[model samples]
Target: MAPGSMGTVFIGDPTAKLPDDLLVEVISRVPYKSTCCCKCVSTRWRDLISHPDHRDKLPRSTLAGFFHATSATEHHRHLSHGYLSVSGNWCRHDAALSFLPKYESLEILDCCNGLLLCRGRKSTDPKTLDYVVCNPATEKWVTVPATKWSWDMSSACLGFDPAVSSHFYVFELVPALAWNPIKRDDYSIEAVGIYSSKVGVWTHPIVLDDPIEILYLSGGAFLSGVLYLCSDNNSVAAIDLEGNCRIIPLPTPHDDPGGPNVYVSRGQLYLTIQGASELSFWVLEDSSSENCWTLKLNISYLRLFGIDYSSSEQFYGVISAHPEHNMIFITKGFRLWY
Candidate 1:
């Protein structure tokens, strides 16, 4: 059989026999699309292709670019979305989500792996919005049913790891009016709305215990089966798939001007704190119990950006960390650096 033509070959001869090891090697050499199609050839072939032992040999997905929303200024009335291709080759994919149903406004809320979570406002009812999960590569999407507290959601996040499961999940953090008599003005996250693709429905919101308020702009990190968000109380709030929750104190000083940002890299949860003159990176040793952080890197702004730090100007903000490497991406002024 011709190399990289496993899909056509296997479909043509379903009964064709080959050693399991050799079949795995051949399938691994083909394109990812062909590898996925090979799973339907037979029970044995599907088992071989799905085997965890052969995962390292399989072809992996490539980074395309980034999706960003345009900020609305005095001149612009509405927010607009756009895509930036890593290779500057935009022709390969459709940046505009033209395949989706029409909506009054569509905002990209969060992205995980290759999927995006969007909020689409209905044209008929401008006040009502639906959550949409879409795969830009395949130009396919599904709208998630709204929960009772969907309108009260303060933030939403996408959780998807192809290696972990074929399905994806949407997590919406719902805020509640402060019931504490002492802190009436303070808002606390009271529940989480979880939607699983496999079930095709949004489960009832799971109420949280000792709920804390989260910084909506700080973003969040979803690692393993839990979601971690930066809390206003100078700590991290972790919520798992079962609705179990815990709060872990921040490792760095709470007075840091840059605050703390959470990220996931190499199957681990990472946190970065920016100080007056330096940036520090930390990795959670164990999120389940210990909640200890190990300082991974500490670098001065002078050495990193060749710029002296001053109280007058904010120098940089972290974009994200490389999922597979020790490197990180940050933005300084208008330029992005790693």
Candidate 2:
């Protein structure tokens, strides 16, 4: 077997076997198209291809970069999708979408650091809803301290600066209304409360905000060291780690001027009309502004499980939204040699 070598190798001998570690090593370095064919060679090969540590062993930043579809088990309404990783064979995860198994309970904003910044809600059983940040990959969790003095929060974000080369994930807790004892100017995100695991201390970055309120979300992409979010007005907002905001209008979708849009994947946003059959991608060029956004691919799959151009980094394995998950299989998209 050769790394980065395209095409399938058939073991016609019928008794040919490969070691587990060596099989995994070769598959990790090969293209997804070749791996798909090799996985069918044997049950042992399938296990190696789907191994959890296979991602960690390879240069891939994330073992699995696609969203995991988890159901709530209530009415089968597709629950929120999160970063689900395949560990060995079982799918594991760690994401911020850990909502209360019940409503009226505030969802905790968990930081990978040994802390959680949560809003103090006066409803529901706090015991059944203790804030927990569990690394589903390793099943490690940390309970958070009580939030007695923080304001009511609506949203938050978690980020890590590669320049700092830190292992811990830092978070910014966004309060619904800033805490003000004597009606102070506490309505905006003034400073980013920094948490450093190396030093075991949370430092507050310098404060700066034009509007008294954080009018955007911190959930887009850190393309070039900046955080971005798709606004309600079909525009993209870029945010700095220190809580600064800059708005850039994404091009109107398909000239409809009125269509539903969503941030499908980080760095790759998309717009899809509800009743229309057209799908578009938000392509941002390095030398242009948001207004210069271009639409690349158009999905004619009417209402498929939606479009995700951001996940184009690798050959995507999309399970069906219906009963038969094999409707979509891996196609030979990109060929390369390691």
Candidate that would win on lDDT: 1
lDDT of model 2 at residue 35? 66
Candidate-wise lDDT, in order: 0.77, 0.43
Clashes of each: 0, 2
Q: Candidate 1's error at 300, in angstroms?
A: 1.2
Tell me which residue pairs clash in candidate 1: none
Off by over 4 Å in 1: 1-61, 87-91, 177-187, 288-291
lDDT of model 2, residue 132: 36
Model 2: runs farther than 4 Å from truth? 1-33, 42-44, 47-134, 139-151, 161-164, 167-218, 253-276, 287-292, 301-338
Q: How well is each residue in 1-338 modelled by candidate 2, as lDDT tens digits? A: 58888868765734346666776777778654566676688787766666776745443322332333344677653344455333223454445435323323344443322223333333465433333334444555444333332334444444443334543434344442454344443335444443434565455543445322433322333434455544455455566645566766656633332233333233343433222344444456542453566666555432343444333343322221111111122211332111
Summarize candidate 1's per-residue lDDT along 73-188 as a digit string, tens digits: 89876677788754222234566687888898788888887788998888999888899999988888989877766665656888888989989889977777423235443347
State model 1's lDDT: 0.77
